[model samples]
Target: MSARFTRPGAGTPVPVRFPRIVREALDNGLRIWTIPYGAIPVATTTLVIARGTGDDPADRHGLASLTGDLLDEGAGDLDAIGVAEAFARLGTHLDIDVGPDAMTMSSAGLARQIERTLELLASVVRQPRLEAADFARIRELRVNRLRQLSRSAGTVADRAYVSAVFGDHAYGHGALGTTRALEATTVDDVRGFWAGHIGPAVATLIVVGDVVAVDVAAAARRVFDAWDATIGSSRIDRPVVAPDRRIHLVDRPGAAQSELRIGHLAPGRSTEDYHALVVLNAVLGGQFTSRINRRLREEQGITYGAHTSFDFRRAAGSFACETSVQSDATAGAVRDVIAELGRMREAAIAPEELAAASASLTRGYVRNFETAGQVARAATQLAVHGLPDDTFDRFVPAIEAIGADQVLDVARRHIRPDEATVVVVGDATVTAEALTAIDRPLQASAPEF
Candidate 1:
């Protein structure tokens, strides 16, 4: 064949072939999954608990996160620093994450040290010291962090946006919570939260690496089986979009730019059209070449970049197109964003656009399992969301098979431009009059700290 001058086009992506998981469980009901992956003699261990900020009591908004922070601050035979040092010695770090629906803590290192790693993870989760001094320090840090976030325009927009959308529902509050609730929280409250919420009955252990499933189960059992504590019931909230409370503007007074969060409540993580939503978002603004990003950033040059996400969680979620634009571009950007939303609902995507979005997702699917830590975390998602074990295995093929009509259908069903909640955190002097030009009513909102 003669040399071709034009660039080559991307071919069909090879579907990801997922490994079979070795699933086990302790008598206490803590499920264990072993995902054997990678050639390196390394592994990752993770414990995912089905309790989080959403489980916080009405008056105790930030308790779950507070409890998470207290873990590893002096456990079995080590203080927080010692716990950290031990993991460092193993060539890894202990990562604890508190999300809207679950709290997950993990560590990765040599598969040879997997047993010790499990022991350390056990100490942090099952027998955290939760000393009075450590509690005070973590509480102070949370307060300081909230105070700092209050001053951040983007953070302010997020807080007000969720508050306005979810109202007083459990999902309404931010993870860090307000200073009012934090100041009222005490160390005893923390201990009570731990006793009532953390247990084997509500958790799953996932180990992925170059190791045997049986050995991993044995090690995990010795460490996690004795966590016979009773886990308390979580708060049940049916969060819906707050009606008649449309545009919320939190004035920053003379700020140079405005942070805008536009959109409303969406389906939870386990929505039936999950694959379509992924491709739909990728085609919308999930990527650099998406419609909104292209119109706002590439064409008009109003902002540096624009993006959107379907923040799917356990029970409910939100769809938002977030962007920071100059003070003068605020109103135009708002209108442009809404127009794009309407366009997505009404328009059928071009063939090339659909192909690119599908490729973007399928081609990168296997990379998620490239590392032990990544594989362990991916497995944790299955446990947390109650998804089928074949979820990852089905991802590439399902995404590749998503046709233009499916995306159009989900877009029409989900994207609500008229019902979208518009929020701006910026200089009200210019934005107030500018945003008023839009159809929705503007209501001034303040960060609820």
Candidate 2:
């Protein structure tokens, strides 16, 4: 890890100046946020489509995912091989990913090669040809992956955990959708998806690194200006909240141990309690030496590792703790975790521990922007959500401002043990028996297995 703060006696501090904000919209409804960082000749661009898996129609569960993957196969006039050769020749680093909430395509290359990079990016987005054969190939790839994933205790537990917590909601499904969904996907389905989801209307084009605002904006306009401007803006419908608590077990036969996952709903990235909850969770279960990890792993010898984290999505997210341990120790380990969580909520934290967690959090906050890629992504997030450009600058003060009492208060309010959904994946007979031994009800149903 790099040093999170400036060293003592470092040269006199120079006031950091971020790029000035410049925003514009093309005639076709594309929005752009440009930040010029001319210290180096490398330019990075992030092209984000607001539509993601959550926007998929009920009948087209994996359409968005399929569309994202197919974009690089062939576009406009470039074949898949040709596109790869082009980017390689230019020494550009390009990546494309589709998530539950959004789809992003980004690249970084020498500023001199930006025009060609943009051309490749635009072709991928505007003219993707989702061939029937390619669709079948990708589907086969995904199905094979699901088969291999079924053999892992940890994978089974995570799938069951989310399903048990979110039920039939969109958030319940993984970004790739289910194996059955992938099987039913078709080439035309993905093409139609690209038409609706990947366009200027849903676009948030971000250019950061060593380039002027005017020149970067011109590059964006050259590539995306003629692209269809009429695709409608993307919108996500509201989701129904899941129930407070439940226990779900996914049974994988012939397994010696159980993989456990406990989940609860929590605030999203935009919540005001976000910073306080980060501190609270770090003190409770977020760290290697956190209360839950120390008590369950070090003291009880329940598992090799245990950790908790908030999903941090655009809407309300899930908080989850995951670990795999001996089937016989499964229930006891879970109970110990719950006990520590309750203790953290009920008692005031020791001042030294609280300070340490706060300091650690402060350090992590500073490290978040050390790379050009990180800065580009953060800038895109700010533009997409209309957040303050100074969002991260206030992070340290916000964490430091949180009082110990406030951490306890948030813990008490957010960490509800009874409302949690617990999932254990292992042999059905042994797993259910173990859970039953702990006085929790056990139902022998089909797990995400």
Using TM-score as the measure, the top candidate is 1
- Native RMSD of candidate 1 (Å): 1.9
lDDT (0 to 1) per candidate: 0.88, 0.75
TM-score of 1: 0.96
Model 1 CA deviation exceeding 4 Å by range: 1-7, 235-237
Per-residue lDDT of candidate 1, residues 1-449 (tens digit):
55597756777666666677898888988988888887999888888999988888879889899999889788978988899998999999898889889999988789999998998888888889999999999999999999888899989999988887777788889988888999999999999999999998889888889999889989988888787887777755558545533789899988999999998888888999999999999999999989999998988887899999999888888899999998889999999999999998887899999999998888767778778887777788888888888888899889988999999999999988898988999899988997888888989889686
Every candidate's CA RMSD: 1.9, 4.0
Clashes of each: 0, 2
Candidate 2: lDDT over CA atoms? 0.75
Candidate that scores best on lDDT = 1
TM-score of each: 0.96, 0.91
